[model samples]
Target: MDTMRDRFAPVVSQVLDEDPRVAVVLAEIGAADFQETARRHPDRVVNVGIREQLLVGAGAGLALTGMRPVLHTFASFLVERPFEQVKLDLGHQGLGAVLVSAAASFDWPAGGFTHMAPGDVALLDTLDGWTVHVPGHPDEAETLLRHAIAAGDDRVYVRLSLQANRAGHPVDGKRPLTVREGRSGVVVAVGPMLDAVLAATEGLDVSVLYTTTVRPFDTAALRRATASAGTDVVLVEPYLAGTSTAVVNDALADLPHRVLGLGVGRGELRRYGTLEEHVAAHGLDAGSLRERISAFLARRDAVPAAS
Candidate 1:
């Protein structure tokens, strides 16, 4: 697996070895690499078979009883299936845990729609106080996982995807990192979308910024970048379309601006296929993104010059 999931197994194992407070509950996922880790620490790495509801509830109980519970499973099973458990069992209780999900968005298309969650972050947005981490690289994934484990009493969600950037970024758990500079506008690449976003915006005169943390939206950093880039921005997320647009809008309310939310097409409600197919169909492929973003910037330029 040329993805974050491959990198995460080791971190989980290390954490299990070192931290007594760190417990991992699984739902029939992570078996390949994590099985041995679970075997070594059976008390901590408990697998709940395919029962997702119990999977989440068990984590909540573990957290409630003073263990730093870390739950693992596919994005669809973790967030979409046992949503209420996540909503009430964890959110309402004001409890803290590390909810790590693999196979993000349409990563497991052969498994079909039964295994996709492009809107997971959007759903998490409705709930209060979740630090969502969507790392663009394996290094960032491990870094964010460590950050969450150290962050006492704070809930953290880490979404893992098959896509990755060319290199790892130096990202903190709280801010967006500016990767490139240009004068025309700013294109913010969220999580796994970085590599694709970078490719899509090549040769275009636009500032490029990246971030793994989605909520508690880093408007301060975004506002700064956009203000410098002429207050024009385009948000390219790796998940559902327009997921972060509202917060971005509120963030840049100090000035008149334009933003384009480029991501998985919400209107394309077809059965899941291969990752490439889903990505292309959503207009998230490099070519499609290039055209869309080019046009977006052109439209902004086409606006009559201010007197």
Candidate 2:
């Protein structure tokens, strides 16, 4: 199975071939992947060469000239380093571009903390009108990429990760897809976290909703899922823990709900380890997740019924 980043070049290359209006700006992160495409569309494919700020600014400039620009880089440099330009040049000026990032959280553990971006989504949440897609499979990433390119000058972020599920699910870039139904609670799994979430919830009485697109926050699907399965929600994300808990609270504001946000912890794990080791350390492995999720849900049994 190809990782999402592995599939990005081919998808973007195909898009560049078909769409003249589409342009790609790179910060020398994945330039080799698009060598052939750059040869064909030299004018549109640009490499800013390690200048993260210029990469975003150039993309915004292209957007200003009525060209749909797709910017690429590692998540840390793409979003965290050039965040000022992203806010002023793109958000403040109301320019739109598709900011595609590689290395989800700790995908490249060997690269150290500088390469990881566990807070990318949380940082983007500060800006408004940005559509974020966290695809769990390459096929879903391809679908979301096409959707973002055709979205008509909207601020979109496509977060590509090395982790992926065994199979791809049909994602429409709007709402969450219900994976399984149960009567006790709802588990909202985002992007590549679906497989572990499924394994953790096996034989457990909880509804699982899978989503590649998380920005719009499918309130309706979440509401419907909780309407039947009770109001306990566990958000299993591949990023910082409690990143989406605020949105979950707002979505279920009128009702009584308990939310357990599970993902990468806030504390820095100074040790550099393999990806699986990192996952286990962060309590994101299936065994750890099962323990956490079960314990959180078990608390509900101790609560007295409303009189």
TM-score, cand. 2 vs. native = 0.97
TM accuracy, model 1: 0.94
Which ten-residue region of model 2 has the weakest summed lDDT?
Answer: 298-307
TM-scores, one per candidate: 0.94, 0.97
lDDT of 1 at 19: 88
Question: What's the lDDT for candidate 2?
Answer: 0.92
Q: Residue by residue across 119-203, what tens digits does model 1's lDDT show? A: 8999988899999999999889989999988889788999988888778988888888888998889898988788888899889
State the RMSD for candidate 1.
3.0
- In order, how many clashes per candidate? 0, 0
The local distance difference test score of each candidate is: 0.86, 0.92
Model 1 lDDT, full chain set: 0.86
How many residue pairs of model 1 clash at the backbone? 0
